[model samples]
Target: MKTTKRVIVLAVLLAAVVSGCGEVTVESETTSTGSASEEKSAVAEKSEEASKASDSEVKAEEPTAEESAAEQPAAEEPADTATLGEKNALASAQNYLRFAPFSAQGLREQLEFEGYSSEEVQYAVEHIDADWNEQALKSAQNYLRFAPFSAQGLREQLEFEGYTSEEAQYAIDHCDADWNEQAAKSAQNYLSLMPFSKQELIDQLIFEGYTREQAEYGVSAAGY
Candidate 1:
């Protein structure tokens, strides 16, 4: 009876130990799984924070509308400002040309003398509406009223006044002044200024750019 009781006690102790070992193993496995889950969550949270931080930095780097405009090149003046300047220049040029004839260069110089800039002067002169040929003709007529001139002399005077050679020739050809009568008038004016012999006056008329025949005719006509 004693031997049987001891065997039963030993078997019961073995079974109890086996049950405790199984519980310990199950508890350890549960803890390991929980720790792994916690580690994964921490990694995901860090990734989310880094992503949000990157998004914020990108937004901060972008420029606003005003800042973007400031960073680019400066814009030009308003179109109206340029247009107004041009209009003022044209008006000033018209006023100047209304009183007198002007060469293209002379007009530009006159505008500049009035304190307009070179570009403005250029714009004004180029836009002025005047017939250059008609201007030359008027200038020639005015000169003839002051003094008699040979055809060549008149052309040279017109050229000196800034008319082109062709324009000067055009004016001379168009003016209906009688060359012989102009020579006679010039001789009379000269003799009125100073006493001269017939030969001396004829030579002087020739020197004044009259033709030899015109000079002879003028001295004879002057009663010299």
Candidate 2:
């Protein structure tokens, strides 16, 4: 009876040791799984925060539509200080210059004739970008195209048109006119108007500012 009692005690002790080992294994497995899950959740939160920061940085670097428009240059505005009368005077002078060339004084006269005051006329002339010498040249050419003129006559005509003496002389020097030919053309025109003998035509040409030699050449060319 003692031997059977000792054998039962040994079996009870072995069962207690096995039960304790099984409980320790189950607790260790549960602790490891919980630690792994916590680390995964922290990493997911960190990744999401970093993604949000990156999106914010991208938005900050871009310019808005309003800012882009502000960077453009503004257009220049027209001057508003001119009076209505001055504006109209300037416009009229510009239109006249566009169609025909004129001396400074001639332009002033035309503006005055249009009933602009002296002050307004002066303003228009001052603002006009005219080369008086060039205008004189153009006027001389226009006269020649319509009718023949001696160099002296052309110079006088330019002066009468309100060109300065210096400007008139410049036109005369550059007119490229052949005096003999001009006298001849004048003689022909006179003959077309009325008959004349050679002496009478030559005298007429001489009276019209041609040299004696030029007048004789003109009468000869007119078949006198």
Poorly placed runs, candidate 1 (over 4 Å):
1-85
Which residue pairs clash within candidate 1? none
lDDT of 1 at 100: 79
Best by TM-score: 2
In order, candidate lDDTs are 0.85, 0.89
State the lDDT at 157 in candidate 1.
87
Model 2, 1-224: lDDT tens digits are 99999999988998999999999999999999999999999999999999999999999998899998898788889777766787788899999988987999899899999999888787788777788898898888889999998887888888999999999998888878899999999999999999998899989998888999999999999896
The deviation in Å at residue 90 for candidate 2 is 1.7
| lDDT per residue (tens digit) for residues 1-224 in model 1 | 99999999999999999999999999999999999999999999999999999999999999999999999998787665446666778798898778877666667777788888877877787778777777788788888899999887898888887788888887888888788888999999999999999989998999888999999888888996
